[model samples]
Target: MGKIVLSTNVTLDGVVQDPDGQEGFELGGWFHQFVGSGDLEAWTAAETEEAQGAEALLLGRRSYEWFASRTPSMADRVSSTWADSMNSLPKYVVSSTLDHPRWRNTTVLNGDAAKEISELKRKVDGQILVYGSYQLVRTLIDHNLADELRLVVFPVVLGTGLRLFGETCRRKPLRLVDTRRVGDGLVSHAYEFVSVNPV
Candidate 1:
């Protein structure tokens, strides 16, 4: 069975919005803030390692479009290696409206999202990576479909933004599998969701 691994970069305050400053958020570019501060290289290496280890990519419609739009320009960037791994991996996107995906080796899951994802978990072996799909991640966690979380935490408090976990999210316990510093200021934490039977 394939494990659903939700991977993302987040601030110390748990904000996951616009890390690269691409979406024009007010406190965007928290990722780039560590570039010259001796963290970017290590962070990039860690991200690359994660990407290379993933068996497949799962994303939401907006994130799929975002990555597709940036794919052409990613070849020459510092993230080129990671981008290469992403582009080469099989991609699954959950969207009712997306009829055709421009990204190569892409599958559009237009049917019931939860059902399709559940079926996918049974069919695919190894890890199925989810990145920046906030809504999708919430749905997985709420439905008890997500298996693990790989968070690369940056040392910054934005005070407010789109957080990874929302207020109405149900209580789910997680077991810390690993925690380590990626760079001078960045920390990587891995957590697995613990199964709990209700009374």
Candidate 2:
């Protein structure tokens, strides 16, 4: 069975909003500001390891559009394994509203997102990676579909914004399987979902 891995970058306070300041969120550029503070080589290596295991990319509509619009440009500018993996991987976008996806190796999945992901899990071998698709990740969490979650935590705290684990998120118990230090104050925590019994 293919694993559904949820990967993300967040502030210390758990904010996962527009880190690049592209979406009009006032606290958008926190991630970029702190880029030089950490061990960039370790962080980049972690990302490359992640891409090396993924079979395809799974994203929400907005994320799909964001990556679709930006990643190809990145591929044109950079010659790296991470860029190559991102630009070449098959990507499935979960959205009811997005009709056409023009990105190379892109497919739009319109239906119950969790169900579609479940079906995809059965068909693919390797990991189905999700990045910056917090809402969809929440759905997968609520439905108990996510296998692993990796969070690259930056040290700064954004006082307010869209958090990775929001108020609406279902409470889940996760096992910390691994941890690694990224750039300066950045750390990556890899967790595996586990069943929790009600007290």
Candidate 3:
């Protein structure tokens, strides 16, 4: 079975939105503005490396839109670098209104996320990676579908914005598998689901 790994760049307060001044949330970009210069490069390299090993990519509509708009010219470049290396890895976008994906090797899924991911895990040989889609990640967590989480926490606080982990979510216990300092001062923490204890 394949693992569903949720990787995100978060703040000290766990905010994950627009770390790179791309989200247009006005207060969105935080990490990039504050973190050390080398941190960003190191972080991206690590993420790209993880993504290269994935058999498929799962994204939320917002993330899909962001990438589609931002990397229009780099479609081929992205595919060749990341998608092609993974044998043209497929992408599943979770959205209700997205009729079709403009990007190649992409599919729009409008169904039970947990069931779909569970089925995908049974069939795929490599990992299924989820990046920068907090909504989808939350759903996966709520459904207990996420197997692991890779968080690169930057040393800054946005004070407000979309958080990586919302306050309404039920507490989920995780086992810290690894921790390392990447880039300048950014800390990367890898955690696996240990158990879903009742609150």
Candidate 4:
């Protein structure tokens, strides 16, 4: 079965909103604060590695639109290799109202998201990577459909923004599979599900 990998960038305080600050959130550009610290090589390398392993992408509506509209224009950027993979990979977007996706190799799924994802897991060969789709990630987690969760935590406290986890999320336990310093102030945490859960 293919593994569902939920990966996203987060602040030290658990904010996951607008890392690039392009989304108009007040603290949107929090992740960009560390850009010129001379540690981007490690950061970009880690990102490239993940993109290399992903077989396909499973994105929510917002993330799909956000990435689809921007990634194609980044082929000449510093991490063009990663951008190429993102643009070329087959993508499945979970949306009920979205239509006319301009991104090639894109499809919209409007049925029961969890059931559809479980079916996808049984068919795909490699990882179904989920990026910056917090709502969909939470749904996958709540349904126990996510096989892995990889969080790259940046050293920042946004105090308030869209968080990685919702307040009413189920108490699912995770086993830390790996932890690494991806960069000077960035830590990557890899986690898998644990049988123990709150009763």
| TM, every model | 0.94, 0.92, 0.86, 0.93
Residue 50 lDDT in candidate 3: 83
Pairs clashing in candidate 4? none
Tens-digit per-residue lDDT, 1-199, candidate 3: 8889998888899888777786588876676577776776676577668867788888899987776665546546444354334335687888889996887778887887778778877887778888888888888888888899999887887788888887536778899999998987989999998775565
- Angstrom error of the Cα, residue 43, model 4: value is 1.4
What's the lDDT for candidate 1? 0.90
Q: What is the lDDT, from 0 to 100, of the residue 131 in candidate 2? A: 93
Weakest 10 consecutive residues of candidate 3 by summed lDDT: 78-87
How many residue pairs clash in model 2?
A: 5
> For model 2, what is the alpha-carbon lDDT of residue 137?
83
Candidate 2 lDDT over residue span 25-141, tens digit each: 987987778777245666777788888789999999889888888777775454387888888899999988887788889888898777888999998898999998888988888
Error of 2 at 55 (Å): 0.7
Better of 2 and 3 by lDDT: 2
TM-score of 4: 0.93
Ranking of all candidate structures by their TM-score, best first: 1, 4, 2, 3
Residue 153 C-alpha lDDT in model 1: 89
lDDT winner between candidates 1 and 3: 1
Name the best candidate (by lDDT). 1
